[model samples]
Target: MIEYVARSGPPEAMNCPAFICDTCRNQVVAEGIVTWATTIGRDGDRGPHQQTPVYVAHKGRCGRGLELWIEQHYPAADGWIDLWDDLEDFVCQLTHNLTNAFADDTEGTYHPHRLVHPKERR
Candidate 1:
């Protein structure tokens, strides 16, 4: 099971809420976490403001527990065409997308994490 712990930054900064997983209970900082930022429109006088949301998973026996959790939660379709045969690849891709979303200046939306089914790309 996954447990969630809320985190916050200084009040001065517009830091969004961050979540920590307690299932695995690891000391690593942001080891298995996803953080994204988006802009919210303000009043006509004020410009849009940025909002960030962070998610972190607890450390499990192995570092790949997050991958396993995702797989279990979102099972692959039968005969799916997976770009990667190992869980590490999935984890890498997820982290890469998350990083990109966090750094994205215009679009801060997170890319969906999913496997391509057979012939689905065409």
Candidate 2:
């Protein structure tokens, strides 16, 4: 689980409104398909309950909305540029990128998730 600290000097939790499907806006967990690449913690009161290698819970809008928000707010970040109509594609890309970053596979070889986008599926 990633912790957010406010610039004002208070410990705060990070919440991304885009992660949840706009319709539900309920809490849900996302998991990585690749075991070695990435891992996300489980949702619980204890904060990041499990160190599982495939699970991230988000609330707000779906991946597509989240991608749009990311592009608008964090333009420099090229991670979630392509929109995903299928949630499965979104999950796959999310896990792949997260796993690569978490593993610190900076060699640009091992993970190589750089330019790959959901559109490539087409």
Candidate 3:
């Protein structure tokens, strides 16, 4: 997993669009897939600034094989640029949350597991 803030330049200089997860195909707004904030400057001299904090991973239930899918489909030759960090902070935090949730062992509470493939299920 990787986490970083992506900034887009002025309207004329804007190149890349917002990051979309390959697993979801931008169909749903899931966590760690597409997080952004738009700020309109009051000066009126510059266009609205968009800052997107992306958290990508390949092990999560929500988005597995996202990185590989993106790599194969959206190669850098087509103007796709890799702009994520090496640290898997998002995955680490997800694991930590799951560990804590399961450790609680609270009654009437549900702990969701990763999505399993139908063929892999026994």
Candidate 4:
């Protein structure tokens, strides 16, 4: 299982890459709250539903499209959970034509931590 921990920086001594936001096309730094998921999506226009994007984005304006996408597809759900988007080439698309996403603004809600390398946690 691919497990993930939400943190802004890599473990001590070494550096891990940061994910560039698909919406803003900017670096999702510490002050910015990010969310991602490896969810199911379409292949194309009316295409077969395939496991699609790792939704990496901030919780507000940059994530508007994803919010709408979820509401149209899964209305019963109360909110969305974000996931990693470390992939160099992200395939899935987030549509913004629908209504706005009432995403619970996640900024400043959680503490962003520095991931401790497993070996370094002695």
Best by TM-score: 4
Candidate with the larger TM-score of 1 and 4: 4
Please report, in order, the local distance difference test score of every candidate based on alpha carbons: 0.38, 0.34, 0.40, 0.40
Ranking by TM-score: 4, 1, 2, 3
- Expressed as tens digits, the lDDT of each residue in 6-116 for candidate 3 is 557775544444334535544232345422222223245254332223534323654445544444444445333334432345447667887576557666444232332
* Candidate 4 lDDT trough over 10 residues, lowest sum: 42-51
* Model 4 C-alpha lDDT per residue in residues 51-71, reported as the tens digit of each score: 223445555676676545534
Tens-digit lDDT string for candidate 1 (1-122): 12344446665545333333434554334444432222233233232333322224443443345445434433344221111123234357767877665556575543333333223333
For candidate 3, what is the TM-score? 0.22
**Between candidates 1 and 3, the TM-score winner:** 1
Candidate 4 Cα deviation (angstroms), residue 48: 13
TM-score of each: 0.27, 0.23, 0.22, 0.30
Query: Candidate 1: TM-score?
Result: 0.27
TM-score of 2: 0.23
Q: List the residue pairs that clash in candidate 2.
A: 20-60, 20-61, 21-62, 30-56, 31-54, 32-54, 37-99, 38-99
RMSD of 3: 20.5
Clash total of candidate 2: 8
Tell me which of candidates 1 and 4 scores higher on lDDT: 4
